[model samples]
Target chain A: MFFHKYKYGLLQTIRNKELTFWALGFTIILGTLFYAAFGNVYENDDIFEAIPVAVVENVGDDGFMQLLTELSQGEDKMLVVNKTDREKAEELLGNGDVEAIITVDESIALSINSTSDSISVSIVGSIVNEYNTKSALFEEIAKTNPEKLPQAIEAMNVNIDNVIKEHKLTDAPMNPYTDYFYNLIAMGILFGSTFGMTIAINSQGNLSAIAARKCVSPAKKSMSAIADILAAVTIVFACSVITILYVKYVLGVELGDRLGMYILTALFGSIMSVSLGYAVGSVGSIGEKAKGAILLTVTLLGGFLSGLMSHGMRQIVESKVPFINRVNPAAILTDAFFSLTVYPHYDRYIRSIIGMAVITVICTVAGIIMTRRKKYASL
Target chain B: MQAFNLAFKILKKNLGAVCMYFGIFFTMVILMTKFNPTDAFTTTKLTIAVRDLDNTTASQMLVEWIGENHDVAEADFDNEDEMLASLYYKEYDYAITIDKGFSEKLANGETDGLFTVSTSPVSYTTAFFDSQLSSFVSNVNCYVAGGFDVDEAVSKTAQSVTAAADINSLDGNEESPDAFEYYRFLGFVLVVIMISALSAVLMTMFKKEVLARTYCSTVSDTKYVMQVILACSVIALGIWLFIVAVSMVFDPQTVFSRTGVLIIINSFVYMIITVEISVVIALLVKNRSAVDMCSNVIGLGMGFLCGVFVPSFMMDESVLMVGKFLPAFWYNRALEIATSSYEQIYNAKDFATCIGVQLLFIVTLMAAILVVIRSKRQQKSL
Candidate 1:
């Protein structure tokens, strides 16, 4: 009998494409938009490459030439030195093959393309300026005090291990863009609450004409309510899971290695959202549009607090008024995902799960109580 | 005039939704407009773990220099695993280990003894530390090379480093920092308000039952649309004026400037484009739920693509190319001109071009919506 009600509830949800699209389709579309917007930002920020420079070796200063040669010969080479004639070097600079052309005359000079303000140009310019200043100082010191020459030479020759070591807790590199996707999933879960609200309204006889017939049926109010809630959660969870999979596989967003944990968060989040919607729907005799407006305002406020709009907002919230993170359900969901991805342990992850569980239980109980109490005198 | 009176009545009935829209948009505008991401470059201090194995004056000086800007904690770790775990758990943003003989290497003018470990392979903090250490070493070398004694060189170098100033100017006559902030966010505020007000007003006028009654009236369909458009325009203008008035309370320079007046004009053109789009959306959507979803998707999607949320410079070339087809893109282009300096504003060609493009969008969208409405009406008459 429960399965009978559940099947009909599932069919009802499938038929309501408006609710289905907002819960599932809109999120997938937004996720793809976010992916396209932030896909290459992570790689560009973290990756390093050699800056190419054209060298017009006019005056051969043994000391500066040795330093440049040593810097260019390493695995993590500072510059990709292209030793060429003035004309060829000018051609390279004009063609944008190299960032700038360096002429080693009586003094080190750099000619940068006026059109480009690239990072390589800045780097080459700074290096040239530093070399000019240092070499001039060395020449002055050598002329004044012959004794300090050995110490200066030794300082210049000191080999530094310039390395950037990855101390990752997880194998996945941190992509700052993933926060938007995390928030998208959280918003998707809350959007599922609309379906739950619809179901709750449909089950209670006082809410609508169709629900009046359901209330008069012999299938039992508690049984039907439970069946509706279950079916809505199943459909919402399917939508959430499909969104997660699409974002992960097709869009190639790195959610995390813990697929099971991600699924668990989504499951709890879906139940919590549906229960929240049910509670909202069961209490209000308000219009569906008004109820949806309330839910939107609440969820959007929650998303804003959780850093859906900007990445730094979450950190700002964490720094100030941290209790909001503890209370906001969207934040809790994203925090669960964040902890699983960022932390080596599951302490915060488990806390988030417990928080979501508590919310789900309370909302589900409240919805059930509210719907059961509405025993219509004339229905 | 009667149709307009009817539009005003419909708007009055839906005043609550309009208020909610205003409240949300204002809250978002206030919150986001105040945050300058560039301020974080100078103000944000990451916590770094310091393990000073070398107990020398040079190492102590380095630690002191680091402490001036960062929250430094002394971490004693037994193994690499523990260090990695602490970093991964976000106990510290960075870890720096000063090995023994580090001071001796610096004293000898050698560069190789400091080690930094962090969860992030690439970090600004690490780069900052490297630059600071390099500068210190180079300063010492420079003073010694200039024939100064070791102690004098060290003190002179320290003093020179201390005297560095912070002057970061990108260009001359830059927009008032706060003015630019508000101007950039105006796109989002306008999108939200336009969608909410336009959809609410038009949706009420064209509700299935309401439209049937309206069709039964003495007025022709063309006059009805004209009235609806006029009423929406009044509301749009009111919204724009309110925004301008409120913006003036914060940054009068932007609102009162020559560019500001141009922005106001361009905003009105953009509003016409939004009204037509909203009418089309109201006609297409079956219910209030679909209206909400449609408005959100259009408002946010266009705002994001057109440089309201994310700066246009940061957007992918393909996304930008796609944005060119959106009215918001031209709106943002006009906004760019409005926030620019006198030289750019004086020419006014870009402003005219962007506004012209937005006007073109309004005409096209209006024509399309009219056809859709007329066809639907004919089918209903049959």
Candidate 2:
């Protein structure tokens, strides 16, 4: 009997095309937009190619030539030197073929077309500056102690390595771009709240005409509520899963490797969202439009707190008033995904799942308690 | 005048919907202003964890150097997995391990293979570190090849790479002190589109259901249509004024500034265009649910493609091509001009062109709506 009721409830929800569109279609559209906007951002940041430099060898200095050869002839080459005369180098700069022209005479000098900041040009300029300073230093050192040059070179390399080593600390990579997708999934789940809200409205005797008709039936109010909520959850869960699959496979977003964990988070997230909606619907005496306003405020505010607006908001909340993360359903859903993908352990993920489950139970119980004892004045 | 009064009464009754419009705009403004994009790059500092497995003089020196700009911390962990766990939880932004004989390898002047690491590549620290390493290595390699003594090369290479040029801006004074441009576009577009569209749908829908009752009344059809439009326009105007007032509260100087006044005028023009489009949408869409769906699609789809949420430069060429047909594209173009410093004669011309294009869209959509409504009325009379 419960299965038949649940099946009928599911069909009613599917028939309501506008509600289904908001819960499912709108989410897919927004998800695709997010994917398009932030997809290539991280990959482009991590890769680099050899910087092209126009080197004008005016004096044919053997030492400088050897240095250029050594730096430019390997797999991880610093530069791709374009050996040219002064005239051609100037033309190359004009045509934008090279970043900067290095005039290798007594002192290394850089010539370029404009001061418009280009990373490659800045690098070339720095290289030229370093070489000139080194040339002056080497001249002084050769004069002071000609035999000590070889040992001096080794010492300089060690010091240089030490200097560069200070800032290059890195190990476990985290892509900042993936946070958008995580927040998007969180949003899709929270949208399930709207379904819960409408279900609660339609099932409560006083709130809706349909619920008033059902109230006259032989089945218990709590039993009907359960069946209705179950049907709504099933529909919402399916939509959320489809959104996840679309994002992961169709959009090609890397949503971690653990499919089981993703499914678990989505399930719990949908249940919590629906219960919240149901509670809001049952507890309030307001109309459908008013209930919708409340749902929008709660979900959008929750999304904002969970870093839907900007990526750093989550970190800010975590650092200050972290209890908000513990309570905000949207934040919890996002954190579950964050833990699965970014964290090395399941501790945070488990905590989020448990938190969602607790909220769901509380909301569902409160909703039932509020609606179970109904004395309808109308219908 | 009677029709006008009745329409105004109806609008007053539905002020709840107007508040929903205000709520959306308020949320958007607050979100855009509070969570600044620049904070990620400018304000935050990277925390680096050093795992000096070598424990040599070279490794220690490397760690010390990394400490110069970054907040260096010791990675107190049992093994690689534990160290990575710290990194994953954002305990440290970066982690590095200096290999054994790193000093010996460097002193011997090897081209590569000194360390292993992972880092937040997007951060300014990574770029600074990368360039510094390249410059230093090249200098050392040159000094050695030039026959400089070991002690002299170390001192000279360190002194050689000191930054020679300080960056100076060409148009530094022209730049706005606070980025008001980024904050303005979303609210104006969202509020105008949502309120005007919803009002038209609701009013037209109400009139359709009570067409026979409305005919029984004294007011003529033309006067009744005009009054309904006038009421919606008044409501749209109220929303526009509210937004302008709010913007003034946040940035009084910008709101009263000459450019701010120009932007306000530009927004008003676009608001009218949106109203006309909304009226046309009411004529086309039959049901309330369809109206809601239409509003959402138009609001979000046009908002994105027309550079309401995303900047115009970020949008693809194909998307922009489609967006050109919409009034919002022109609206954003005019906004772009208004927000930017009016330094050139071309800016004034571009502003006029954008406003002109918006007016053209309004005329076209209004014409279409009138034709459709006339045919429907004729069919009803038959």
Best by DockQ: 1
- Candidate 1 has an interface RMSD (Å) of 6.7
lDDT of 2 at A150: 64
What's the DockQ of model 2?
0.19
The true-versus-predicted C-alpha distance at residue B7 of model 1, in Å, is 1.7
| lDDT minimum window of 10 residues, candidate 1 chain A | A113-122
State the lDDT of candidate 1 residue by residue for A217-327, as single tens digits. 777788888888899999999998998889889998887788788888899999999998998888758787778877887688899888787674665686568888887
Instruction: Name the top lDDT candidate.
Output: 1
Off by over 4 Å in 2: A43-150, A153-174, A284-290, A343-345, A373-379, B5-93, B96-116, B120-128, B133-206, B209-214, B231-269, B286-293, B333-360
Look at candidate 1 and tell me the lDDT of residue A272. Answer: 91
lDDT of 2 by residue, B1-382 (tens): 7655665665566555566656776766566667444211121245787677777654565566556545876675445544543454455766766667655654566646555666654443455456555666556555555564334444455655553522222223243313254344542455345444445444553565566677788877777767766766676677667767777887777768877777778777877776766676667776666666666667666676666776665556667787798788788777767766222222788989998998888788778878987998899789
Candidate 2 has which clashing residue pairs, if any? A149-B148, A152-B149, A152-B150, A166-B65, A166-B66, A169-B95, A170-B95, A170-B118, A170-B119, A171-B118
TM-score of chain B alone in model 2: 0.75
Q: Model 1: which docking level applies?
A: acceptable
Candidate 1 per-residue lDDT over residues B268-348, each given as its tens digit: 787677777777887877677677777778877887777777666556778879889988888887776666521123347
Top candidate (TM-score): 1
